[model samples]
Target: MADKSLSVYKYMCKYVVGTENHIKTIRLMNTFTDNLSSNNIKVTITSGSFGEGLQMVGSDLDIMLVDTTIDVHDEIKSIVFNPTQTNFALMTEDIKAGFAMLRFISSPNPAIRKICEKFKGSNYLSNALFKKSFLSELCPVLHGPCISDKSGHLDFAHCLHSKYWVTSASQWTMRSNNSWPNESTKQMIIKYGVLFVPIGSKGSNNEDLEWRMSFSVGEKFLIYTFSHTQLLVMHS
Candidate 1:
């Protein structure tokens, strides 16, 4: 057999989105949303090809859905965190408190800090809700809390949606930590610190106080992590 052209890969990378299967994946996730309505699961199409620039080539689509019905309080109780030790100073008390709650749930370890940062806006509501949100929506498209199984070594989600054989993966924002940062990234964060965006005041009582948030900084860095090839590979 002669060499099969890279044209195939190029073609796949080119029109990855709006493809038949991708459309079907959208429909399927929407269907999952509809079907699970009784279960009170709000399935938002999160952190996939469209969001992460990782749209790939096949009916075997990657879909992330946030199960809003889940209450993550117990998980937070188990996690060990000390906000006073965090290097995330230079922000407002309110902003700091929000990040502290996020750090409590998401960016506990310095090593995975970069990873955790990338998915921050996904849980932007978490910033507003603080401790109530946890790290459910943020993180990468493929990162989310794993739903347990009684069967074999499937640490991920698998299902047959419209006979398309959809394979899914997830990571929760909740994390267990016993330590803090001691690396270059930590140094940089401490020096530069988290930023805040002016989104206006909080309420009638506090019109003078503008609402500024630095939550998306993590996701911004996460977006940067995707190199050209990685973006193509992810989309593929």
Candidate 2:
């Protein structure tokens, strides 16, 4: 039994588990995909299980389309006026954790102004309306925060990029840990900031105005730091 277990582990490490070269190839493929898919307004990011170089069967290709034209900031003062991009302030007060309301600050883009609505004397972006606008003849199904094709092979999450990190995750940065995720990795995670998916907390009153915070970029970074043995263990 012990010999069989050892053989299985060795096989997994040699074949099933992805090596650093495999990860590099996956990253290169992702970069190529991104280059082909990305445009002036939005940047494409490959995500999910495959993004981590774990090629599991029957897994959908997860993609995040980050709107470069839109900018989200945690605080009003942190926002810098850009003549070309739409700006939104992330409002977290009284809202559920991992979710926030995007207050429409200013936008030179006419299309953005058309989707925004006034609520309680404040301009706010409607998550529903924003998502609705993305629906078309080809991709009509709304699967959670992602827009999926009829075949369900692909999931595209339309999201906004924020330059500033959220205040809610501040504790994570200060958390003491002897091993795993060094200070440099933490800084890199913070530097990338976060993405806002076009979804809200279920049963929340501000569902239409709220966007869920996504730490996928940082999560991917952490996954890349995993060793071959760690990957094999995770796969098992």
TM-score of every model versus the real structure = 0.24, 0.91
> How many residue pairs clash in all the candidates, one count each?
14, 0
Cα deviation of 111 in candidate 2 (Å)?
2.0
Q: Enumerate residue pairs that collide in model 2.
A: none
- Candidate 1's residue-wise lDDT over 1-236, tens digit each? 12455665557645763444454465466556546643443433333333343344442333333333322221233444344232221212343232222222333335323322223333211222222223233321221222223332222221101111101101112122332322433333333333332222445232222223332323423543545555445555
TM-score of 1: 0.24
Worst 10 residues of 1 by lDDT: 160-169
lDDT of each: 0.32, 0.85
Which whole-number lDDT from 0 to 100 does residue 172 have in model 2?
85
